[model samples]
Target chain A: MDKLTTVEGRAYPFGMKNVDTDIVIPAHWLKTISRSGLGQGAFEVLRKQPGNVFDDPAYAGSPILIAGDNFGCGSSREHAAWALADLGIKVVIAPSFSDIFSGNAFKNGILTVVLPQDAVDRLMEVAKTDPIHVDLEAQSVTTPFQDRFHFEIDPFRKQCLLGGLDEIGLTLGEADVIDSYEARQAQERPWIVPSAAPAVA
Target chain B: MVKPRTLYEKIWDAHVVERRPDGTCLIYIDRHLVHEVTSPQAFEGLRLAGRKVRRPDLTLAVPDHNLPTTPRRDAAGNRIPISDPQSAQQLAALERNAPEFGVRLIGDADPEQGIVHVVGPEQGFTLPGTTLVCGDSHTSSHGALGALAFGIGTSEVEHVLATQTLLLKQSKTMAVVVDGELAPGVTPKDVALAICGAIGTAGGTGHVMEYRGSVFRDMSIEGRLTVANMSIEAGARSGLFAPDDKTLAYLKGRPMAPAGADWDAAVAYWKTLVTDDGATFDKTVVIDAADIVPTVTWGTSPEDVVPITGVVPDPGSFEDASKQDAVRKSLDYMGLTAGQRMQDVAIEHIFIGSCTNSRIEDLRAAAALLKGRHVASGIKHAMVVPGSGLVKAQAEAEGLDRIFLDAGFEWREPGCSACLGMNPDKVPAGERCASTSNRNFMGRQGPGARTHLVSPAMAAAAAITGRLTDVRELMTTQKGMVA
Candidate 1:
């Protein structure tokens, strides 16, 4: 998959904390190994209610989600990230996100932006009306009315997402460095050779 | 200047290799336990890259999911067919992969087997002052013995398997000290939930907590596990209790445990992992055990809690703008009214099992409550699922299953059932339940199913009342007068 250079879309305001992965994508929907058919199950319980956010036509196909503090609070299930991406949620603006969920979202190319609760409240208000522009390279979210909000991301994760590389890709990118280190370590610590070769098979 | 060092810091520094510029560390994984649900992809990553497990000696795999608890009856004899085909395939994959990579595996039929987290500590694979990683979030359960344990994603799993070290940012440390003794009938589950209530779910953010105090010292190893298991609910990296004589006793002669001189050496080293006198912490929060009442989650989050005798909190009581909105939505979805007495609230079902409280001790407590008693006729489903096969066998041998079955509870096989509806065990949509699981997050039990987190004894009381009633009140009534 190619890296997402820019994320531009409307934001849905879900001002609630502890939005667990189970709620994002229920485990029953995880019967399959494929990534497809996930959007159908994205927030199925939430969508069951009449006039819920996902069901409301006003916020249909919004690519941004403005969430309250402690979003994505439970489970390390990557399916949550997959479901959000499949549903076109490009940026999640929350006061905070669970560490596991944030890591998973980063790996799956979803931008989890941490804003202060006050900033989140403002975005929640603004998302009710206008689209938001998220420029990954610039690391900012801009309102259609021309207000800009800057955020920070781990440079390593930013590089990975921009390059569309996973952990393997990150390691492979430094393959030469790793190989050279290994060659040097072989001379310095020959006892490490037996273990290293055993794992290379 | 005073240098602040908490038990968490003591453990972290003991395990640290070298700090990097970015604040993350290349921490060595002393133990890596994997289960069926989270290992397949990591194995696939390894296959794609042509790499074997970096430190097979430190890695262990176990089969818990899709392994039936019951012995399936065939014409020949009783046989459990790995009853679910997909799980069978995954188990077979592990069987094929583990040996090929020189990793040890505890198969389903192995007598030393149970849930991966359960068996790890039981077999002494997890120890104090070590960093442990698993692909499951509840890996934090191992922290009860003062180990630094956390869950990682599949990619990270692959990273650890390939390198035996993970690049992780160090977390801030906090101390949660509990003074005084727990009242009678209150279990570790109650104490854990009460702490969650006091801390408000996100209180432990960005921190790793070391549980201290006299109360923790008196708690059994099982009780300490219960307390540490739910640290994630409070949003901490993990929770820990310094390994003591109790920990050494539990690990004394278990399979895979260090033997003879090594065992003594390991314990001596573990004793030094404790926080030294005059150590300081980044944050400190103290709780009076006497003030902790049996508590349960009244709303979507673990922090949405109240004492057993308290009423549902009105949204008007919350000052946070977002909390009010959330309480409103949760009340609307739960069909609950503000200021409703928690004791009077009726429930449609009761669930007593999960990694949170599915050990033998929890089962025994629930069975004692239901002895010679029947569940209320209105209570539709009162179910008990064991945490693992070993737990089921232990309970059945003690006739705990009989107590549950006679009380109108459906005793089902274990595999994280009803904990979050991962399998066929689930409450129907819109039904309310008193659950013994750690999480009571929205839709955690099932779609639209309201789950009130309670201790096993309280869940038993709810089973008898068909409503959320205080176990203390039930005991009073059982003494022939309603308190």
Candidate 2:
């Protein structure tokens, strides 16, 4: 994951708020443990309607989604992110995403871009015609029409996503800290460290 | 930099195994709780990979979703067929799966059996200063006991089962302090709803909340559980209440809890989990509990709440244009006008049971309301479920079931019925119901169903009036225990 100053990609704008995880991916699709092939299952209900948004040729294969406020406000289902990532949605721009959904998105390497409602409204309007460029390094989304918007991301998360690091990567990065802490704990809370031989592997 | 500050900071620091250039950490899960709906796939994954549960002792399983609400025995004490096949099968799967994995299962018919959320605390499984994970969102309910309890996905569930740990990112910390006293009639449901309304649903984003206030201090363990249970709705991963005597009393002598000599040791461990004085937090919000009114949600989201007497909000009042469509949709589906007073609105159904409000206390409160009078005509009402077989049996022995039935309400078997539309007890589409369940999101009950969250007593009043009515009025009209 290289630092992305700007990501110019096709846009998929969904209209409305509180677009819950159930709507993102239905419970029926949860029968499998594998995260693969979930993209097809994403928004299956919406895709069922005639002239559905996700199926629109204009937004097809788009990796960016501009959405309304209060997006993703139901259950804490991580499948929502899995489906989005599987469908090539690398960035989700909304007035605000549900906290659980945002955490899930971040872990799965989907950039949850939060802008003001007005900004989101404008983006939704602009998304109909052209690709949007998101620069993680600059913390901004820019358009061909010269529209520019700035948003904030946790500096640490930005570093992780830019470097394509997952939780395992994060842990190893702080190996020195963990090792030192363990050593200190061994001295202070010796009882916590079992005196018996380590249990069977 | 200086050591991370705040309880969330300390917790995150303690759990972190490493941090990648990306922001997530490899955090260890101290405890894992599982249920039927989310476990099947994880079990399948293990079967496919020929793997075993890594630390069976740390994992616990329970059946709540598919358990029959009906009594398990008849007058002659014989087993009976469950009224709902789906629930029966779901419980059967849990019963079969738990034994296979060598994990404890509190079966539907087991006295220890109950809603996973309720049983965890009641059995003393939830401990302070631990990272607890469940496959259900309401896992946040456990945080009332001071643990960092949160939900996980099936893959994460399998990950925890295989390694007793979960890969995760840390969350920010939010502190909510409520001052002043609650009004006489206000309940924990109202307090939680008030918080949700004030916070606008997403205010607690990227944070685990520590509830600190006089109101929280005075609240019972049950009340704290109700408040913490809805933390996810406010977009917080968990809500914590500092453990006190109430918590200890609740956990004492439970079957799974440490016995005799170990009890003191366990208490000593729990005492050390609290935050020290002068701890700092990332954000803090303060509210006066006296300002809160008995609350009910007017729309699908938990954020769409107001004082009980207040009317549905006009869509124009919403600043975000995006919310307008949802307001209109919810109003259309609920058959409500923008200015319609919630108290003046008529309701067709009242559901008085769910993991959120189903307990001995909730049942007693509703039963007190229906002691003598019958439910209003045109109102279909029921206390269709409880958390466990023991709860149902105890309710019957105490004649609470008879009181409910006498009031023209159906007394049915226990399950997560009508809460999430996972079974047969769903409200019909387009019907308005006063429910005691947690989520009120659009179509959460069923296709096009309208739901309003309320306390059990409030739900009972609605049942008796065929409309949204306050419980205080009825409580004043009657006497004896209201729990």
Candidate 3:
């Protein structure tokens, strides 16, 4: 994972509210094992409509998405986050987000910036004609039109995102502590530990 | 004196492996349930990183989302047909990965094969005082038995697979106390939907809800499971009802449960797992169960629900502009008019199965309503899918299958059928379905398919009337016929 500090690019200003995981990537696309190539399936239903912003050449390869309140409000399919990442969306500015989707987005290095609904509305307007900027270090989003909006994220998540530290990296970082705890647990509760062979052939 | 602890805090404190300076905790997981759709990439990530599963015994895998509910066996009891190529490929991937990775895989042919949530409880893999995770959001279903179970994304799934732990921030606890007894015909599903309607979908965000008070205390384990299953629908991390005698009796003598002596010790420990009296929660909501009616979701979100006797609400009735806009959009998508009676809304399909309401008890409830009735003439399709093979066999033994078949409803094999369109059983495009599933999101059943989430009896009533008829009305009519 690459460290994320600032995401500055034209944003697809699709401020559709309650855009669920089903719309992000349909269940049909979930059949494939690979996470790659999801960009093609991202917003499959919406892209079929005439002149949808996702298909417009103006915002092609945008690094940010301006969305309405309660974005990603459906299934816990990480494919929603994967599809957004594959489509080159690095930052999603929304009034609110579903907790599970926000977790998925953070884990995938996508910055889910929580802004006021008014701020998101302004960004949606600016994004139609100009690029927007998001600075994770400063915890702020700014448009080319001099509209600056501040946001707040959990300090721990911000650090993890800036450091490119995933859960695996974090767990492995505390390996010694985990090992000691496990040893104590095994000694205390032998019944919970299965006596299977270490490796199954 | 030490502060009294809520059930959420007690369970959460017990599972903490390590606490970080930033207030996040590394919680050890007791179980991990896996399915075909969301886990393939996580396993692939493991292979790419050259990591082995840290605790394969703690993980259980099954193929449910895409498994066909239609029986594939011939008259001679031999396997004849197969799933679609893509679904079959995903199942094949699970089969190929499970043995090599040392995880237990329950294939479609296995009698234990079912919706992961249903299988976990029935097989006694989900016990009290445990923390469980799965890639699917409905994993909250396990929390009904007093476990701290919730959904995780693929990355967290991989993290759990590699190390039986998750790096998580502690969620605030909310107490949802439903007092008084429910009205006659109002099931736990109605209670859950009524709560969602009261709080809105985002009300429980960033919180784990502990359902308490007299209503939850008196609810059967199956009913508790239904209520807990929809916790995610309210945007809560998970919902739990503390384990009791019913929970223990439900688990006793199951395949994976502890033996005689161990069972007594486990029960002793579980007895101490309740919330201490006077424990303060971050938030508390009290509802009168008598106020709840037979409920149904009328829009895309689960919170867009109303009593079955109510009319579709006008967007103009909402004060907030955004909420008004959302209501209008949802109404447009659902092809409904304001002031239209929900009972008058005709439906083309009826699906009575999901992780939500597909257990043997659910089947019996629906069958009890449909035993001497027939599906309406105008209905195009009606199906009853059991939750698991065990549940299916039990339903067959009780003659529920014959009752459904006699009522013009197709009695199908067990899987997550018509809940999401991952399988062949789906409400066709532009069709309206009265479903017993949790989610009623657009395209959840199929593309352009509109779903009205209902209880099993309500779904059976809809099947018999070709409309969203209130189950209580049907009950009264049946009594009158008997008189």
Candidate 4:
């Protein structure tokens, strides 16, 4: 994962509410093991429509997406987040997000900013012709039109994103403490943490 | 005085390995359920990182989502080969990866093969006072047994595989209490749907809901499973009910459950998992079970539901303009008009299986209604898919298969068929289906296929009438005709 500080680019102004994971990447695209090439299948259904914003070259490779409320509203498939990342969407501004989807996005180094619906609407309007900027360090989103909207993020997640620290890395960072805890837990409740015998063949 | 602890807090506290200053914690996972669709990338991630599973014995892999539900035996009762290339590849991937990683893989031909959610509880891997995770959203189904279970993404899946733990943030707790007794003919499915209707799809966002009160206490393990399975549909990652005698009875003698003195100790610990009398919650919702009716979803989202006797809602009824627009889109996509009675709506197909309602109790409920009846002549296709090979065998042993087959419903093998159309069992485009599965999202069953979410009994009734008929009304009408 790459360290994410600021995402500045033209955003796709779809602004569709309750856009579920199914619409993000259909089940058919989930067959592949590789996470690459999902960008081609990202929004395959919506992109097929003539003059759809996803297909318009004007916003191609946009680093941000302006969406409506309840974005990523279905399925726990991480393919939704993979598709968005593959399509170069680094930040998604919506009024709200499904918890599972937000967690998925954060793990993939994508920023999900929850702003008021009015702020989201303004961003959607500005994204039609102008680029928008999101500064994770300052916790604000600003457009060239002098429009600025503040947001909040969990300090832990913000640090992880800025540090490019995945869960494994974070766990390894606390190696000494985890080692001691496991040693104590083994002595306290040996039955709970069973011996790691080889799985049945 | 010390504050009372909710069930969520009790279980969460038990699993926390370390709590950080930023409120994040490292939670130990007791079990990891894996399936074909979601595990491929995760295994690839593990291989790329050159990491081996920290606890291979704690992980179980099964092929369900992409397996063909069609029976794989010939007329001679010999095993036939899988014909679908995509399904074969997904199954082959699991078979190859599981052995190399030292994880147990339940292949398509294995007797234990079933949907991960169904198999977890049935095999006693989903124990009370434990934490479980899977890449599929319906993992909350195991929370019925008092586990802190929820779905995770592939990245988190890989993390669990490598470390046997996850970096988790604590969620707020909400208590949903259903008091009073349920009306006749209304099942837990109705209660779940009604709750979704009461609270919009995003009602429980960022919270874990603890279902309590008399209704939950009296509910059978199967009924509790049905209700907990839909917590994700209401935007909650997980739903839980404290384990009781029913849960203990369900787990006893299972393949993986603790036995003898261990069982006694496990039960004692589970009993202590209840919410304290004076516990407080971030949000509290009370629903009267008597007020709930046989309910079904009328539109795309789970929240777009109505009572069986009610009519489709008009978009104008919504106060929010965005919500109104959503309703319009849903109505247009579902091919329904406002003010139209749901009973008058016709359906072309019926699917009676999913993680939501594919248990022995669900099968028996549907079978009891269809024993002496036949499917309507106007219906195009109807199928009954069991949740697992064990469930299918149990149903056959109980002669429930005969009732379904005798009523002109196809008896299919165990897999997630017709639920999301990942396999060949799909409702054709533009066709309407009365389904017992959870989601009613557009293109969920198949592209452009409309779905009306219902209970098993409601689906059986719809099959008999070729429309959305209330099961209670049909039962009364049949009794009157017989008299």
TM-score, chain B, each candidate = 0.93, 0.93, 0.98, 0.97
For residues B327-437, write the lDDT of model 2, one tens digit per residue. Answer: 887777677898988888778888887778877777887887778877778785555476555567788899999898888888776667778766666777788889988
- The CA lDDT at B216 in model 4 is 91
Displacement of the residue B24 alpha carbon in candidate 1, Å: 1.7
Candidate with top lDDT is 4
- TM-score of every prediction relative to native: 0.89, 0.85, 0.96, 0.96
lDDT values of the candidates? 0.77, 0.75, 0.87, 0.88
Candidate 3's error at B441, in angstroms?
0.6
Off by over 4 Å in 2: A1-9, A25-52, A55-57, A82-90, A106-111, A114-119, A132-201, B1-25, B47-51, B66-97, B478-483
Candidate 1 chain A: worst-modelled 10 consecutive residues by lDDT: A192-201
In terms of docking quality, model 3 is acceptable
Local accuracy of candidate 3 as per-residue lDDT tens digits, A45-153 = 7887799999999999999988887788778999999999999899998999999999999999999999888888888889889988899999989877789988898
Error of 2 at B318 (Å): 2.9
lDDT of 2 by residue, A1-201 (tens): 323445677888786677877678765454444556889889875776688779999888998988776688767777788899899888999988876677678777889999998788888888888889998888999988899999999887787688776444334445466556556644543332212221111
lDDT of 4 by residue, B1-483 (tens): 857999999989887889988888998888899999888888988898788887787898888887888877779977676777776777788889999999877777677788899988888878888889999988988989999999999888998888888888899998999999998889999999998998877898889999998999999999999999999988889999998889999988777777776677777888898999898899988999889999999998999889999999999999989889989989988999999999999999999999999999999999988887888887899999999989999999999999999999999889989889578888888899999999998788878889999999999999888899889977777532311
| TM-score of candidate 3 to 2 decimals | 0.96
Q: Whose TM-score is higher: candidate 1's or candidate 3's?
A: 3
Report the Cα RMSD per candidate. 4.5, 5.2, 2.4, 2.2
Residue B218 accuracy (lDDT) in model 1: 95
- State the DockQ, from 0 to 1, for candidate 3: 0.47
